[model samples]
Target: MPATEFQQSSSSSSSSSSPSFGFSILSRRRDQVHSHSMESPPAGLENELEAFQRQVADRFHDLSAADSGELLSIPWLRKLLDAFLCCHEEFRAILFNNQPYLNKPPLERQISDFFERSVKALDVCNAIRDGIEQMRQWQKPLEIVLCALDNQRSIGEGQIRRAKKALIDLTIGMLDEKESSTALAHRNRSFGRNNLHKEHKSLGHFRSLSWSVSRNWSAARQLQAISNNLVAPRSNEILSTNGLNLAVFTMSYVLLFVMWALVAAIPCQDRGLQTHFAISKQFLWAGPILSLHERILEESKKRARRNACGLLKEIYEIEQCARHLNELVDNTQLPLPEEKERELRITVEEAGNVCKSLKDGLDPLERQVREVFRRIVRNRTQGLDSTGGGD
Candidate 1:
């Protein structure tokens, strides 16, 4: 499908009446089920399912609308996470409202598979949270560089030397992180630490299981595990389950894409985007998701970006600014020339801007990642409970 068609479809769905129309349809159908009927008509139920798919497509359409400057940026990533959360909630509602079909033949097997995939994703979230902490460590050296060169009374040899040291530290840190797959294992951090001690005995296994996947765990392999056996529902399966199987398939793909995007944007161990899955364009949401996937892959293939620790725009900017400043400092003599000093200050100001962007953005981004982790845990717990403890 062409991109423009996706945009047109999304635009039509975003009209003011669309939301109310969807709500009224669902509300009336739900009322019928609650009052006079034990099961909604298949046609009415299908309308609800179609609305759910459109909403997923609309959310991703908005995400893919980001310009080049915004793509893979911190703010853009947060929006991506927000979109996933929204879709997840809506998918959960669909399952809740159609509890009868959940434990039935095809959907029962499909949902169990989804929950297993979601469990694998929890490890990704933990690794991603650790990756966020890794980014924070990089910030320390970056801040040192900013402090040394920013708003100085005069650009002098001592300040230049100090900033150079910080730049070298930042350089080494990024390089070590990129090259060493096991480096993060030594730190031993997880999202479950604070809550692990407080949970009841029955929940202990789940809490630990969610938080403490092995240190040798590979994000690349974890992603592959999630993608394993994931395929679109066949027509017969969809017809048999009142389309709930299709909903499970959609949520599974969304979960996989969101995790893949997180690994791409953050500095995680064994970061790889090569996990293979294809979505036919028959699904409305496939266009934007596949567009985004291709765009991010193209970004990773760029000469300057290919070897970087992460593909975050801010990370790229910081590395560029730091490289320029490092080169300037290396060739300058004590009693720096006017031209060199002026060039140095300009580079420092540019680095400062990147730093400012990180300073303002990282906290909120981490919080969003944390929220994603917690929500996945809650959703998995609820799902397993609903299924009478999934296999």
Candidate 2:
């Protein structure tokens, strides 16, 4: 079926349901699931499937509701990961309940493709974790700035000099990271380090050599790999699979968009947002997901953020605060003027706040990324087992 035909079908369904914002369609789907006679596929199964879609829509709707200040913040990113994990768990449950379908023809193919895309996403999780570590490195210099000027009775030339040196380091680090085309793969980090032995034993052929990613790996190309050949299921395929194909398609998009968002918000190698979304707005989740995509793109295009290594709000805050303080320190004399000290102290305080935010957020963010990685691995391993070892 042509995409326009799918869109029209979805639009008519949504319109008839009178979806208000987030969930009227869910209610309608539930009603339809219940209304089905005993001759149809298990109403309970169809209800679970529709509920999964509704849950995904609700989670993303909440994420999209974030204000501009909260959108790309560490807390917001955590929420995004949380939402993905929740949706993934529910999706896994649905597949487990309908295990027979997974080994069947159309669904087997669809499920196989989803797992492949998910395997590609594991690399992105590793890359994003590296990006998180990069931000942690930035935090060290930020801490030096805070230590130099924070909570002191009076500022001194020695402290100013120390802070100036740290600021320079911070500047150089940020600039080098932003301008470098090389991947962080040189760091040689992967979530598998602690359990490589276990994963190798269990994952079998599903284990990706790119688990640690190569030095030449490009996030842009990896994203393309995930999205390659992803398309909406035709009407016949949907009917044949009893709508499980739609679930697979939904999860594929969710995987792609989440990885894309992480690359956009975090520092990663060859970060690019040019991946085509191509989702029809007929999906309840598509509206919020695409809205966020456009908003992040707008943020990247802003003059100040254009060349930033990461679009993270805290990263921007650190850059701006450090730059302003560095300028002030360079222009000031040995016996600092009262105004200069006041200005320096204010900038230092601002930088300190940014540091504190990172301190509170980075560890949790890394933990969440780690969880996402482990979840993907477990899902793929189990999914393959359920499907009698996927191709």
Candidate 3:
């Protein structure tokens, strides 16, 4: 071989025989680039996530079943939901970006856990979204009922005013007739006893007219009283029923938003080392990782499928009650009938029951979600540690 060619060939052979130093240097450079790419995203995301979390927490922390006014504010509610969804999307992106490392042995469990979290979060979002849609659906009916009540009130007030004015005019006419009859009686007494019988007859006529006027006035007053009583209760019933429905709607959102927050927080924990080992193991994988992944998927699927149908049915019942109230308010009747009033009360009670049942369902669901995710994180950490030590 030529001297220069020989030297070059020997150097190439040496490089091939031991490539660790070169590989390590190259890996360090790659890691630096990867970390740089990761830096801005995680830092920015952390602040975004924390702010959202704090807002959600603050908004709901003190809220209770009674705080429907604040809870039912649509603009506030929409903003709250938007914050939750934004957090979810950001978390999803972070997970997806890490997907290149997820499909293998030990880290597969953690990935499965993440997938589990994502699915649960999505389910909660759907429930909240459904409830919000239902709330929106009530808007038109609510407006219709309010307008109808206002129009009816205006018309009723005008009628009452007219009735009072008629009563006043009748009383004045009777008073004038009474004064003229008294004057005639005095004149007849002065003129002589011959006109005494005529004066007595005229006085009798005036007395009869006064009695009739009194009866008419009393009847009018009674009717006005009845109308007032009727209107007061019906208005109260409609208002109370609608308020309960709103409370139920607000409660659903609160529950789901809380769940979403929890789900968002889970994947924010450290998983990179576990993921690396897992992906590396994929090349020659074996044992518990596969089983763990399956278990995670199955458990998550099972948990997510826990149906809220009962709660949904109750929500529908409240919706029906809302419709009923709207119809009642739109009626020309000042007060709803006794039977209808009983029914209104019943509907209100049923709504309260449904809310209690929904709360009962939510508590268990929350517990189950927390437990499942906890198990997942525990398993992922333990599995990765054991696998690493074994290797």
lDDT of 3 at 331: 30
lDDT of each: 0.74, 0.76, 0.31
224-294 per-residue lDDT for model 3 (tens digits):
22222111112222122211111112222333333433322111111011111111111111112233233
- Considering every candidate listed, which one attains the maximal TM-score? 2
**Alpha-carbon deviation at 47 in model 3, angstroms:** 10
Model 2 agreement with the true structure over 1-391: per-residue lDDT tens digits: 3111223233423332544243333333445655443224555765676667767777887888899999899999999999999999999888888777788878898899999999899889999887777777778877988888889887788887788667655654565334421222122122123323333332222122233557678899999999999998876566566677788998889999999999988987788888988787766677788889889999999998888888889988987897688778775786788888888888888888898999999999999999999999999998999999845
Which of the predicted structures, 1 or 2, would earn the higher TM-score when compared with the native?
A: 2
The TM-score ranking, best first, is 2, 1, 3
Give candidate 2's error at residue 313 in angstroms: 0.6
Clashes of 2: 0
lDDT of 1 by residue, 326-352 (tens): 778764687877887788888888888
lDDT for 5 (candidate 3): 11
Error of 2 at 51 (Å): 0.8
